[model samples]
Target chain A: MPAPMPDISRQYQRREQLTMLALAFPALLMILLLVVLPVGWLAWQSIWHDGFTLENYRRILAEDIYWRSFALTFEISLTVTVLAVLLGYPIAYAASIVSRGWSIVILALVVLPFWTSVLVRAYAWLALLQRTGVINQLLRQLGLIDAPLALVHNTFGTVVATLHILLPFMVLPLYATMQKIPRDLLQAGASLGAGPVLTFWQIFLPLSLPGVLAGCTLVFVLSLGFYITPELLGGGRTVMVSMLVSRNVELYDQWGAASAVGVVLLLAVAAIFFVVSRFVPLDRVLGQR
Target chain B: MVRIVAQPSATQRGRPLDKGGESVDIRSASKHYDAVRALDNVSLNVAPREFVSLLGPSGSGKTTLLGILGGFIPPSSGSIHFGDRDVTLLPPHKRDIGVVFQNYALFPHMSVGENVAFPLRARQLPKADWPDKVRAALAMVGLAGYESRGISQLSGGQRQRVALARAMIFEPRLILMDEPLSALDKQLREAMQIELRELHKRIGATIIYVTHDQREALTMSDRVAILKDGKLVQIDKPQRLHDHPADSFVASFIGEASLLPVRRADACSVVLGPAILRSTRPVPDGDELMLAVHSEKLLIDDGAGDAARNRLTGKVTDVVYQGESLRVFLQLADGTSLSLRQPSHYEAARRIPPLGGELTVTLHPEDTIVVPKARP
Candidate 1:
């Protein structure tokens, strides 16, 4: 007896499914081993310290130090995101419009810091931003100020360093988006009786919103878990969630407390991702479409 | 959500529906980029409500002239005057002229209504008057009730209509179009040429249209300006441009005509290989002359031995069966080859000579066009 057409088609579909699974198996296995297993262990440790009690979470909520760290983390991330947008947008715009050779040079300068160690760059900022540093000395030589300003070892230094480190993240996506905007649209806007300023406001700005959104989301999320720059520049004064998690583990050897803090920070980042994804698709935020 | 606004008469508002166009006087304008002369010493005048087309091949500086007039490109020298105002250095927004781009350039981010309302917003018109104005503009383009549609959802023709509606929504006196129909298909482009003529008549705006298609220029414009190598070659009415071309280049470019080298025989005649052809127009002053043979003007000789018509003998090389007409290719005794078109009816088909057979043709004195060879 010959097999039916539907049966043969079903067999072909089964083979296609098996092929797709085989192609995806390596990456899936790596994720299962590296990310899922560690996160599961952390969650289990956070709750099952003493017969699965919720004591670690309770202590985290009742503690004032943990609350301050969480609040400070959000405050700094917001400030950095806003500053990155203001400072990075013009650089990206300039790069987009310049000649191709100059545009590559500007982009190369932005990416130059990535070749150096993050710790080295953070320490370099410390040297330049300290009291009576290069900026203060120049100001004094110019007779601008009588006394040196407090430029380092505080939230100011932390923000300055963090913005410098994260600016490339904001600029690259903005340049990508701005370069794709057709020059004809700008000319059309002008010929339709719009001045340069009005044309930029109505046409250019709206078309670049995708880049702005993508850059802000990336910088903000990365700022949440930032450790080295804040640690070196914050001078142990500006505490963040990551700092708290490390302190609980290294100083006190409280594995359950550290795991609980880790789990909470992870949930916070996930919640933010969820909210932003509701507004813009994930692929678009990653500058895919 | 789509909002179907209430319709109102154009006169109900204070806007002038009967406004005539503005006269444009471009005087000796020239544009240079680096060392290349994009436009050189080209001066053109356009009367109010007159439709003039700038026709040329690619890189012929037709677009550069339009750009200078539209204020997108600054002229390296000379000035432009609109009516009594000299607007040589004015910016595009302050000049108050509309422009329709080739690709339409409609805002992909805005709805169809918003795209049309953009000019009004830029001019700072009243907020309450937008809905009625947008509706009227859309209706003019035969796209009524499409205000809520997204630009991505519309077809190419619909997008073109939307672009037209947006450009003319504010009713500028001078409108500039840069090859706007080049993106459309052949059938759609022909249909639009007529529609555009009717629209120009109703609006009464002085439209400076740029195109590279010679047929389109002859079909639509009251006066067609031909450009060559950044120079104004010829500017005349379409019929005159077709009937009496300025030179051999203009003769061959404006329509289907073959040029054959000839010598001057008299004050009003020229001599081909063995025949003397008379022209009603004056012979141009040049060292060399060529005769332009319009394919449609040539008739199959009936062997009646007409005296007024110039006759020539040739051998039929090939015949092509076009849908409505038959093309007969022939080779003259002096090695000059030319083709003529005849109707594809049964009688005409039977009259056509066989391939490689001798055939006699005649051209009337009025149809004989002899022009000077253009100086390179």
Candidate 2:
């Protein structure tokens, strides 16, 4: 008969659990200190003003300007997500199919802009999209238009700048997923009588949906709270939730209203994530087993 | 055992189309990647419903030939004909061929039924008949009632069956297999080999199989095409290939052979280490000649006055005990090593020759083949 192994296995299990906890302690502590504590404080501030009143919530729900800001935020975020995906899919597919050296070069170019600050990128777009910018100057010199087009300080400027900033977030996930698909599967599909377009639609596109969802979710959530690009490029015309929160804090000194707006944005982003996750697994989007 | 219902051919399902089996003719096919020639100018003809295996070692361009046949790779200078139709420049989707990849590249997101129905959907066949055809194909591969199972849920052998079912569901004229069974275990691989051969017979579809396994080629192929270094060495029936290899490379690649350096005495005879060996076939013209003898053809001399033509006496070097047979290694007087295989149930195994003991073996003239040495 074999010796009893329950005690030994139980002891080993306890040690394994302890080791996992020990290894995870640093990250957990950092998240608690940096993220959870601040969010919890903001949530508390949103409701509790000397006696835990619902005044900030009621005021946000009743205000028309705040509602407009929330609507504009979602509209711009959705538009930016769509544009990023449209532009990023082809770039990601090209990177996935090219040779290793070429793929590295493409990926390097995609990531190169990340070295510069987002504010700097936004400022550069401002220079290019302004009335007297290089694009307007070129159009005028070419005799294309008599008047300068209103490219910046509006929804157009916000979307173009935001898409430029969020494109890599969309492309990197797509490339990761597309690169994992075996080349043989496409060949097999073709041999089974699928043309290039049909094969792409049936095999390649479906397999890449996870990456699309991942990139869209990341871009959308990040765009929800986006402030720098819209603020610098929109020229105070395109008002979003983040800009509203800053106005409430900086100009009006309304800490309660600002905290409430921050909390609402967090919940809205979480809700969008929950809905997307219901359709496709979040781990698949992240390319994790 | 589930009884499979008889079904019409892929083209005969509510449509009057050409039958699936079409003869293939590959003429002077070649592929070059800049300086490296993956496939040299080579020509081959495959009969309708014939099972041909392209057998070679790695980097021998067998897979390249298969790819060229499937239209996956365009040859540098060659034309492919499918029943007199020049399909040289045709795309893979327009070729109407089925391909089974080495990794069994089934769509992971699709279920078994959907995978089997992919080709039909690609052809824009009627959706109403898809379920019945999918079921019939699954039943043909002995995997009925598994339509809804996810790809990841099935084992390796089951996935292979799914791939086969998917390939044949459309009743393609030709199917290309690229080392499909190399991923299976030994016993399973052997079983699948027989099943695949039977499947080929039942479907009557022309098959072009590429594998590096000599045993598999001999077991399942109607004819084995041996290749080396982007060149076709020989193409013949398995038994003929084993008996009369065109050169030393074909001899060594087809089976276990020991090529002994010999001098050609004449057209039908050669001088070995110490004895003159006569071959049943005439020797081809070459500077260097070698006597290629299969290990199984060497028999121990029972001292009954046998009339075999060639005899060799050597010292026993070693004996390896296989499960069903014993492999005896002997070194000739001139230091040429020869291996002989004897069944374990044979009388020779009762008393294995000890190391350093004199062992005399006889070989019939018909069993010995003389071929030219490989080029350096």
Candidate 3:
């Protein structure tokens, strides 16, 4: 209405906005079509036998076998996460205290296994934690055990393997976060009449919480979908939800049941994310260096 | 209602106030990182109820000494005494000290009242005394009615005042300030400097202030310790450190000055370049002595000054017109140059001083400060 010809500033701005939208639309649609479409289709398949039925969910909820695997998966993940926290915090703190050169050395050692393939790492764990592996062999030579302990193809093996693989995921983020909280803040805490324990409790512990939350979230979420580590080390005895879903789809050739279980796992992850993000902005916590 | 709280009983009672009224002794304190010594053999005595500033350039160990006093770092050598009692091996929490950091390390998670109440809580003070002390400390710093506000809501000056309040809540024996006003703007820093001086006088508590800013140190401190390369170079009053610097570093660090290298020839005499000069006192021979003369102290005259004392003839190289004064740069025939700055009210600089023109200037013996040679 105002102009017959183009106003360069207005036209350029409009063109820029249109171009940005045009460029981003394909990627956006790809995410929606690939991820969102599959998730929605799984949600639909979860409740419907042919048209609409809650039998699959009812069977999952009512059965102890399904419930046992769900509980054991959560239990293994949570315990491994807590154990990793206990083991990782001290190493991170030590790295923060030592000289930069030594800190880098220890840091590299802690995170070095992350560069290796997780399946290879899990297999490496199987090689170490198996019945006649070096650990049991050492125990025998040390006269601690008369026989090799069963360390593989079970819940213990799964947890041990996952902790080994995810130990870096916890330590690196915590080390990065600990490096940021200025050393003076702790010193200031001590100078103001807080003992080292109290300083750790009040300042260090609380400040490192964001990293703890992030590491826990990643470890817990990924452990929910653990197909390789638990599949390899869990040794057919521990049929977790991922292995369960894979068996249903590949072995039984039941697409509907697999999709149903997948939907349940997805919802469980979303639910945990919903619960944790209430205390912390999950994006900010995870996105921070 | 006078209670006789004796020092021994008070000391036994584990109260910091009893140990409050004596100078702190830091003897042969040294901190080393592998081979590099951050502070070396630094033995300093902070007098009771006196404000002393550790003035130095960055990385000169002023903050390290303060950190040791504040119990943040352990010295590789020597002991520290609070009053007459030695407390060298004590951890930070055992030492009842208050610290105000340069960044004004206020607890962002807490309110103003909560921040100020932290020290009292640290001392395990009676619950009843906290509110009264908090009110008094906040009122003392003129931050009344701002108790409920967040740290983000306060201005830089207000944040500093809150920090001061928090540091003094328990009435600690000594307050260790590590450049507390450094993070503020110039106007706010200057204002806080005056406020800090008033607070020191009002409280009469022993304070060890650390700063790289010379003007702030010179203005507020009763005595200033100049540190260079982890060693205490000089410790003197403001006027003394300014008027009679102990060495060339002190002269240059304290304020702006033009140092002309001079050689001692005989008693009451020295030669600056080719010009042999007479002095009021005997400058000792065989040591390299630098004669530090302030810019304003040099008098320039166009007329022939054959009658001048310690007079020298030099050609003017540059004349800088400051709004209030003029800084006259001169190069002697021996290739030594000096800058003489005088107030604009003293107009002799304008009439006859031209670049490359020969001018005569006089350096007074009494006005001149004799600085010792550099330490190896």
**Most accurate candidate by DockQ:** 2
Put down candidate 3 lDDT per residue, A176-246, tens digits, no spaces: 88888877677767778878787787778877877787777777777778889999998999888988898
Interface RMSD of each: 0.8, 0.6, 1.5
lDDT of 1 at A137: 85
Q: Score residue B274 of candidate 3 by CA lDDT.
A: 77
Candidate 3 pairs with clashing backbones: none
Q: What CAPRI grade goes to candidate 3?
A: medium
Could you tally the backbone clashes for each prediction?
Answer: 0, 0, 0
lDDT of 1 by residue, A124-191 (tens): 99889888688888888899989987888889999999999999999999999999998878888988
Q: Pick the candidate with the highest lDDT.
A: 2
Of models 1 and 2, which has the larger lDDT?
2
Ranking by DockQ: 2, 1, 3
lDDT of 1 at A279: 77
lDDT of 3 by residue, B340-365 (tens): 88777755646546689988888776
- Collision count of model 1: 0
Q: By DockQ thresholds, what CAPRI class is model 1?
A: medium
Cα error, residue A99 of model 2, in Å, equals: 3.7
| Candidate 1 vs candidate 3, lDDT winner | 1
The best candidate in terms of TM-score:
2
lDDT digits (tens) for residues B117-198 of candidate 2: 9999999999999998898888888899999999999999999999999998898888899999999999999999999987
For candidate 3, give the lDDT of residue B153.
Answer: 98
